[model samples]
Every structure is written in structure tokens, then in C-alpha cells.
Target: MGNNHGSLKKEATQPQHSTTNNSKDEKKIDSRTEQSGKTLVDIPDDLMRKIIPYLGLIDRSNLAVTCRRFYEAEAKAGNSKNSEIWDSVGIDEKGKKVSMYKCFFEDVDDESGRYSIMRTKRMILSLKKTTPATTNAVIQRIFRATTATKMEKLEAAMQLNDCHSESQSEED
Candidate 1:
């Protein structure tokens, strides 16, 4: 019975399995993620854009340098809202769909993200601050120069020449 007691105790206790391999793999993944940067890079651009607005400029700039994907995504997600930018310019109708346009950051249009007036405007404002001021007669001059307003004028002219077209079109 004394000899059987040792075997019974051994059988009753569960064997402790070593986690050496798993620990090594986990450590590797942790180090790789830290070295490569945050795993947030894997998120989709649209969703990322919503999250982007909540981050301050400093944080955005930091994340921007993380990777090429983040840079492009950050640029697209900057202060601009596609509809607001488009509507403000009066050129919303010029582009078939703003979402389809090429993003400024990416040279390759094949997979480039959406264009952003907010990003463009931000750049313009930064430049404006550094340059000498040129006092224009009125802000109206600036408004007319916008691409959207220009396009709207061009469309009006073309429709104006089309006398046979319905007069109802002019009301728009």
C-alpha cells in the first residue's frame, strides 16, 4: 500500500506543461509589433479617418511618420469633410463622385485614396502665413477663383448657348 500511494498521488496530479515555445513566439510578436509600430495600421482608411479627427495635430503627425499607409490615410482624413469641401467650392457637381478622386499624397492613382480640400486648404493657409500679403479688392475675387465655382460658371455658359434646351434648366 505504501508503494501504491506514490503512484496514486502521481496519477491524481495533472502534469505541468512547459510554455517555452509559446512564450518565445509571444515575445517575438510583441517585439515585432513594438519595432514595426502600433497594430492600428491594419485598420481600414474610412474607419481610421473617423478616429483621426479625435487625435491632436501632434499625435496625427507622429502617426503619419509611422508608415506610408498611415501617412496617406492621415492626409485624407485631415480637417476636410468631402461634402463640406465640395459644397463650399460649388464644384461638388464637377467631380462625378468625390470619393473616386485621387488623393494628393499618393502618386499612383491605381489605389490612391480620396482627395481632401481640407488638406489642400491647410497647406494653402500654411503657405499664406509665410508669404507677403496681397490685398485683393474683395473676397468675391477669391470665391470666383475656386475650381467648383469656376466649373459652375462654365456649365452655365455651355447651357446658355443651348437655347433649344428647356428653360427649367436655368433655374438650377
Candidate 2:
């Protein structure tokens, strides 16, 4: 009886050991599967430009810091004259016609992450133009006033234009 009992105990312990070994093997297989799924490669430049605009300014900045490829991509995209991508984000182009006041109000009203990018872009432009101090002061004033009066004045001008158009129609 003692021999039989000893044999049964050994059999039970063997299965438990086998199960543990199987689980460990399963874990190793899972790890390899996950690793195989991870492919490290450079993102295409055009795709990166499109994606950068959608990302928040901080995220875009961090991406630029990741590699020279990303930094160059961002700079190229921002400087593209045909794109107007930077202007859409409220950034003024270098040596290009831009309403400083309009850009300021646009930046102030823009709550999107593009605002930071616009500000940074403007600062860079200002530095290039040697007017950083003046530009900074103008931006501060725009923010302080919230551009409310400017918006109101624009609305008033539109209303006057509408009235003038209606009067001219009646005269016709």
C-alpha cells in the first residue's frame, strides 16, 4: 500500500511540473509573437508632415526632437511657400505680406494646439526680421484685449457694407 501511495504522489507531482513548464513555454511564445509585431522603421516624410499638423504642438515638438529626419521634415513643411500650412496655423511667412494685427487676433482666438505652433513660428520669423520685441508686445496686447473690439469693428463694417448694398439695389 505504501509503495502504491508513493507512486500516486509522484504521478500527481509530475503532472503539476509539466503544467508549469507548459505555461512557461506558452509565455515565451507570446513574448516572441509580440516582439515580431513591433517593426521599427522611419515614417515617410510626406506622411510625417500631414501627421505633424494634426498633432498638438508639444507632440510635434517632441517628435522633432526624436530624430534629424523629423526635424528636417517639420522645417521643410513650415517653410514651404506653396503649402501655406504655417499660415493656416496663424504663422506669418518670412518676407511675405501678413497682417500682424490679424495674425495676433487669430492666434488669441485659436484655442487649438496650433496656437503654440503659430506663436513659435511667428517668434522665429520675428527673430529673422529683428523685430522680436515689438512683435512680442503686440501679441501681448492682443491677448490682453481678447481682440473683442476688433471683432466688433469688423462686424460693424460688414453691416455697413450690407446696408450700402441694399440701398444701391433699391436705387437700381
Candidate 3:
């Protein structure tokens, strides 16, 4: 009877250990995948933090697809508290100013807008120096951005016009 109890305990503990190990292995495999279709393990968090602010949204999205650590670092660096990183990309402001500045941009997720404006300006500057072959691609990207902004503005105007018409109809 004693020997049977000991064997049962060993059987229970061994499966638990294996299941835990299997879960950890799955997480490791998932986190090691890279956006560039390669497997990379254990990129230092400090290096990711340092490099993250310099990347545009597209670059960050590409990098985050590769590793869990990079994705966390990107999320941390996106907010107002990371103004030093934003300043490095040419949107100059102290970290303390972020909260107050954000209040004025209440209509949208202002962090993206600030980052986009800075990146677009930098891209425009870069376009000035690129060769003719690269110019077309750059121009297309800029045009697409401008077109999107215009469409947003047009949509807003349409919404406002609809509101006025509806209110006038209600009065009638």
C-alpha cells in the first residue's frame, strides 16, 4: 500500500512539471518570431528602449511583430511621458508638458498625431535629398498621407452640415 501511494505521487508531480514546461516552451517559441521571418531570442530590453523612439509607426509595427519585448517597449515609448524620445524625432517638449499639451488635442489620440506630424516633416525633408528613382515612391507616400487627411476633414464637414440640417428640420 505504501509503495503504491509513492508511485501515484510521482506520477502526479511529473505530469504537472511537464505541462508547466510545455507552456513555457510555447511562449518562448511565440516570442522568438520576427517580422522579417526570422527567429531571434533575447534581444536586450535596454537596447530596444533606446532604439524605439527613433522608429516611425511603421517601423515600430514591423519590429513589434518580431518579439514580445519589443512590443512592450514600443507601447511604453508611445505615451507623453517619453517626450525625450519624441524630442529626438524633432517634436521638442519636456516630459512634464505632455499632459497639458494632450488636453488641447482631446478629439483624437494625440500621441499618434504628434508623431505623425514629426515623421511626415522629416520624410518631406528626406525627399529633397533623394534621387529621382526614389522620389516617386516618396511622393506617393506623402500624397497618400495628404489625401487621408483631406478625407478626414471632408468627413467632418459633412457631419457638421448634416447636424445643422437636422436641427433646422426639427425647428420646421
Worst 10 residues of 2 by lDDT: 1-10
Question: In terms of TM-score, which candidate is strongest?
Answer: 2
RMSD for each model, in Å, please? 21.8, 22.8, 19.3
Clash pairs for candidate 1: 91-148
lDDT of each: 0.39, 0.40, 0.41
Clash count, predicted structure 3: 1
- Show model 3 residue runs off by greater than 4 Å: 1-41, 78-172
Of the candidates numbered 1 and 2, which has the greater lDDT value? 2
Going through the candidates in the order shown, the clash numbers are: 1, 0, 1
User: Candidate 2: what lDDT?
Assistant: 0.40
The collision pairs in model 2 are: none
TM-score of 3: 0.28
| Quality of model 3 by C-alpha lDDT | 0.41
Please write out the lDDT profile of model 1 over residues 1-172, one tens digit for every residue: 0011122222212222334666554555566566875456556677887787777545666876665555656666746333233234333323322232323212211322323333332322322222122111111222243333445534433432242123224333
Give the distance in Å from residue 58's predicted Cα in candidate 2 to where it truly belongs. 0.6
Best candidate (score: lDDT): 3
List the candidates ranked by TM-score, beginning with the highest. 2, 1, 3
